[model samples]
Target: MSTEEFDPSRWDGRDLPYIPGEFSDPDGVALHDDYDADIDPVTYEVVRHSLWNINREAGETIQNLAVSPIALITRDFQTGILTESAEFVFFGQYLQYFSGTMDIFTKWIMENRAEDPGIEPGDMFLHNDPTVGTPHQPDVALVAPVFHEEKVFAWVSNLIHQNDVGGTVPGSFCPNAVDTYWDPPSIPPIKIVEGGEISTEKEDLYRRQSRTPQNLSMDLRAGIAANERAKGRIEELIEKYGATTVKGVMRRLNDSGQESIKETLSKIPDGTWRERAYQERSMTGDDGVYPLELTLTKEGDELTFSNEGTSEQAGAINQPFAAWRGTILSAANVLLQPEQMGATGGLVRQLNFRPEPRTITAPDHTAAVSPSGIYSNQVSLSMANSVISKMMLSSQDEEIRNGAMTPTSAQWQCHIGDGFTDDGEYFLAPMTNCMMGSTGATPKRDGRFANGHMWIPEARGPNTEEYEQSWPILYLYVKEHGDTGGAGERRGGNGGKICYTMHGGEMELGVYTTDAIPKTPGLFGGYPGSRGETVVLQDSDVKDRFAAGELPTDITEIDGENVETVGKGPAIELDDDGITEWWWAGCSGYGDPAHRDPELVATDVRQGGVTVETAESVYGVVLTDDGDVDGEATESRREALFEQRLDEATTVDDIVAGDEAVEAGGGD
Candidate 1:
């Protein structure tokens, strides 16, 4: 359908199809008239734990086998179990966003290949098309069907972010692309494995399109292995408990998730909460900021999210309907049902999305969405959290208000480079410095430093030693930058900074895509974090200084032929003597900085998380020479600061003054 013709309102009332081995809707629907049975509590618990453990094991298998740092180090992958009807049953604790895409892919398989190739034992399907529920090109999904008594019982799925997928850029992030055609070749929902054997032609075709064929091949194998492991575990469950009981247990799990979410919603006050977030464009000449607006309405036990006034689809930053929906679901999972298992399809059924098509949230099929999973997904997620947190704050329950989590930083900071190693090995490396940023501050506590991205808290970057060994780069230092976090009563955590230079080879090509504007803004009276930057010093005096056993702590100390500041742009070549310095953006704070404790401000200054001047100016905290807070001086300075703020504050007349007021008064 064309973007203009699509209407999300039509998508709201569609009935969920009833299928065997899947959970029925909470409205009490059945797959078949004769298929009604009660699950034994003992058997239900056993099957539930089995499914959860299977997903966990499958994730471990992927982590063990995958060669890409995105998988092994960053944990940018997920494993899940689905019913025969393609309902999500259980998923691993990896990237929470990938939890919903498996069902979409499996359902497509069932609808398209029900009688053609057919869903049979040992069969596996592969897909990565954004139109078919994938968020981006690199996140490839592999699914395998589990058979019981010659009928489909469940499906096991695995998704992983490939190192490269043959896009305009080596890492599949095409900042220069204006359309989907510029991205890696889209793979439709198709069978890549049949009867437990890989299709050589299909596998070869898939691998041939990637820039790093060897790494992609290994990731594909890892996904297949994970799916196989899930299949075996499902079969074992069937062998232990009869098919009928297993199916009943699956239904119960869904019912539990549905009831839990409904209960949470009922306790929350009914109201409409709206919030807006923006994506800073990375492509040159695209200076416009794309805004994503979200309106969340809560009534009784149902929640509806609408993106009616968001920006239209443009650039490569757009997201498809599936990704938009997934982002909302992920946010809901964290805010409402965080303590429960995410396998239940009931939560997905309970919520509704009213996204106007042609917007960045619901882009046209032809639009490029290469960065949606990391960039736009983060935007959508933050917007969702912003609205939800507002609702929680308005609640009468003190626990709920205090437990709310403000929006965190998104994936606006990244650095990718491709070059040959010292041993003549070509390498495409994505710097993991983006993963070391702080999380958003909570209502009652400060944010966590080096806490990784908000989407995947479990994400981790490789050590300096590991990076030095893997690529031809030398890390001068990697640590938290001083005065980087957003200043508040409960300040946000600080982000890290990294300095590196070529060891034995020049960086033939490099891509620096990050947010020149701060993407993570604080809530209430808290200040927004600092924006990240990429500084490159070409033909520097690093070798001479290092040879003399004098290491420069800052980039200013290094003499260079030319100094260039690359801010969110396309790929460029780097000289051998160039030094690249990257500073990650900090997370948002929770309250006004002036309300912060003087002693705490002194501690922040001592730890290098805040400058002494920032402590004095922002927090109004005067520190003594020995790094201790001067209580008497701090009180006087704070009073003066408050008076200054009152003096500089804008009055109502300033807004309605001059020509605007004259026009309103009809004086022309």
Candidate 2:
């Protein structure tokens, strides 16, 4: 796993060893023009490794630097704070890099790469193109390259999911997208910084294009600051350990990471596991059903994922092949080896991916990929499910229920409009953070109610009050729906709630989300989670209540079941989706109800998450005169219910067929 081991066998003939017109291998020698070429190869390698390590460390530190004041933002790829040079587009999968605006980023790189003077040490580069180094256009990246003495050593990058970019719809993400030009938040290659200075012209231009300029500007600034900090740290490392040692450490880090992955591969039972999941047409618009198929192979210590047999969707579920491959690998490594971080590390070495074009994960650029962005998280969930159901199935874990790591996924969008304020001053703002869905629960714990994606650690909820104060929308309550989690011995997580009030302004609202519907399924007796929704609240009576002291906070009810009370408009059933109109939390449960502790079920009821009747019917546990469990009665009821549940499990196919027959006969 050293430079010597990097031979032609790994070559796919996709691209040559280096840029056709540029140097053979940019990483092989000193990149800065003023650097001396007489340095020994051994010394040069050491220097390269040191810089690479510096970049790696920086990457882990500044990854989720939320500077999107009112917008989505993140770092750039390949370019690190310590390895300043011309923009290196990587000329590969852009969406895989989690960057925003693929076409914009590629154009930026090409323009900057051609500059004779070249980008400087402290300069920050920005772009977001799937073809360049990102998955979709909404993800933005800020990158910097560090130089030492006179030689370029390493790179630093940060990635972020922006809420919106101009597109055909309010949310920058258009599931029906047919052309790249229709994509929102598409930022092309442009030097927002030069010699550590922010260009006013570039800033204004960028702000003008965004509906949420305030947040967009803030995120842009944050990305710049993060890169600057990365640059400072790299310089300090070089001054302390010298460039050679740092470079050596980086090379070792990558090699060591690869070795660790290979070892893990060796331990797995060697065989292919073929698994497939579906994104029903109900959730994917006119697009037919989309399938995610995998053939996992383990050859001694080498593991690969072959997606050759998967079919493609005509709708938005499709994604760029290269980016999809990287995303799948990322999900695999994240679940199996989270300890190994970095865009390039052990995960990249021990794995191989085969995503043939036209499949959902490997679609043409012109095809809609919004569904890919929405349902791609299933990759990680399914991989975790397969591994757990196989290797860990016999253990206490027993099933894949609660095996997924990603709790909630999101899709954010923004709308742009022109209008005058109450004071007559023209103003504009973009919408963000309006959509999110919870993930399936894990074996050990409940998935977080509504939360961020697995790849995003610190992607947190915005301060609602603060958002209202700064923007033209009134902040609503952000709460978790009870019983929204899947039911199991270990239940999955629930989703969060959001309510926004419109102020007197003309603007577009943004929505970014995944798993909004078509639940993140649970395994081995666990139920699937709930979907998400976006709604506009309109009612003068409700507004009047808010204006009075009667309602100080925003409130939105998430109805999971459609049963209505005699007095109350609709009896809120906080369980699974069943004729429920409001968006509820996810239903990610594990194990069977019979396995649940009677005491825990009682506590859940006491907390108002479940009704007393539901506990009695679902758990078959009775309450005593003293409000405690009637042990004798409960025992008898449990035995009877257990038998019934077992019987119900046996005739699931018949039940499904009966339901289909009833539906065909015009039954409710």
Candidate 3:
């Protein structure tokens, strides 16, 4: 599988060339003789723990050494170890989506570059092509091959989100671009290191393509260092236990993971669960909202996912095949095997995807995939969770259903700007505050508020003081928005509101890609969360108000000559008199709000999470003058609200009867 032999145009996006035969084997295939004969239980445990620790250390090393805020603050990166066959053995807890990507690129290296570049110790490969394995162009992967006894034993990999990679826009996310070429130049599997020596030409070429070359250079070095550290630790393990024993332990880990997933699947009842999610093509405005539908079929020990009725590729919102697969894998890891780290390869073996080429979930080679990596990939994961939750809820197993959370929001809004610092230095980067958002509610508990990203809960926004100290900006306010989470019995988490203004220098703010879209939808009878808001105020009275010892508690109270609501576009200028405010959408809730307890509603009111009017109207809870729950009045109000809801609801028979009844029932 040379570079010449591989054709991106011919790829259906369903199959990768490097996946092992064991991944396709669902009948519990026996291990090789060498794997079965030489490994003891104690040695296997030692090897497993050693590999996990190496992955952790690799992640910490990248975070400590990288200069980008994306790594140091938001932690938008991952490190993992893969078997010689490209199976994911140990994945760091940083970012889940990058775990599947490790398998994709590692296999690509083995198939195409094994003989050409000659895979050996100290040889490393770099690639970031969404058509092959990467989720998007911004995420670059560095893979190093480890060898013991003069043969390839394992691979260590690192992936990071570079802020600027020489794209049409300042950030790699090019919302207005119509094709892949408009984004950064795609780097195929190229040898950046050979025999412990760096390829200066390749490194320079990679860095020269970024608007912030120095930042990219630092990130590249950090990735290489992390991979090298992991490689050294793996070699140390092989030195202690023979290479054959280490390989045997890796095999045993995969086998155990397979058995665990199979056992879990057996508990789920055989059924076909269907769900549909929509993505707005606001870049073109008229392109309309496209649907990404999933029909998950569970049979015995296998689950098949089909995107049969998804919209075709039309705009920049379309995603590549790897994103669809990686997002699904990420969701499965959290939903099915939350407690395990070695089940990815085995899970991929048990799962299958039926995707149509040219669709949003499996875009063609010429389709634009950069801008939609964060948007469409998150939607795909939410769609996966929708069907997965349905299956889990329908199961008789308590543990499976207990593990489910309400559907998560996949859309993350990022703000990037570039300008001169107060010290006469230039800077351009994404605000790490974009990482803060709400998480979905669970069956028994409310969602976590501002608990970082849904995909990587450990990743969080930088502190306000730290951000202001680094950049020429003043923080007006950074706090959780009141009453923004969806209203339900068990309410969703609240998203945050951030307002900032230029301090000592002027900068150009990049237009956001996501706006006013309900990406995180509610489940059952719960209401969906509010749409995200982005507001810009030019020549505002904020400075005057600050001088007068007054600060606005809300964005609408500010006075400005020109107020604008912006979405996907090119960058715009901002002066010292300008202010920008962003309020992120909250997570979805679990149950009906009318059934919520009055005491809980009163508590929410006391905490400023719900207003008195909203409590009475939405939750049917009446609060007295002293902010205490009026139990009698609340019960009467809830009874009336329940009756009104019953009158508006349609029965299952109406849906079965089709057009006339549905039309009369006002079904959309």
Report the C-alpha displacement of residue 101, candidate 2, in angstroms.
Answer: 12
Model 1 TM-score, 2 decimals:
0.91
- What is the C-alpha lDDT profile of model 3 across 1-668, one tens digit per residue? 11222234345233322222223211221122245446777877888888889989999899889888878788988888987767888778887787777876776566566667567777888877777677788888999878766656778998998877877777778777677777778788889988888899998888887888899888888999999999999889888887778777777777788888899998888888777777776353445777778888898888887788888886677776767877777878888887776346567668876667778888766777777655787788777877787788777888888787776665666677877887788777577575776777777777766786557756878888887877788888888877878888888877777889888876887645446557666777766765666778888888999999998877788988655554565576877888888776677777899888789889888987778888999999998999999889999998999899889998878667644443222222
By TM-score, how accurate is candidate 3? 0.92
The superposed Cα distance between candidate 3 and the true structure at residue 413, in angstroms, equals 1.7
Question: lDDT of each prediction vs. the true structure?
Answer: 0.75, 0.48, 0.76
lDDT head-to-head 1 vs 3, winner: 3
Segments of candidate 1 deviating more than 4 angstroms: 1-37, 561-563, 651-668
Q: What is candidate 1's lDDT per residue for 1-668, written digit by digit as tens?
A: 11223343233211211111232322211122122268767777888888889989999999999999878887888888877666677756787777667776676667556667676678888888777677788889998878776667778898898898887877887766788898788787778889888899998888887879999888889999999988888788777876777777777787788898787777688888877677767354477887778888888877888897788888888876676777777777777676766665667667766667668877766778786755777777777777777788778877777767667665556777888876778888877767765777777887767877666656777788878888888988888887777888888788778888889865644457446666666778777766777777888989899999999888778888654554446566777788878877777777889998888889888988899999999999999999999999999999999999999899656878555543212221
Better of 1 and 2 by TM-score: 1
Q: All candidates' TM-scores?
A: 0.91, 0.71, 0.92
Candidate 1 residue 440 C-alpha distance from true site, Å = 1.5
lDDT for each residue of candidate 2 in 491-585, tens digit (9 for 90 to 100) = 66665555544565433322223232343555566655555554433333444554565643433342222232211011121211111112434
Q: Where does model 3 exceed 4 Å of error?
A: 1-33, 36-39, 282-287, 649-668
Best by lDDT: 3
- The collision pairs in model 3 are none
- Rate residue 35 of model 1 by lDDT: 22
Error of 2 at 662 (Å): 26
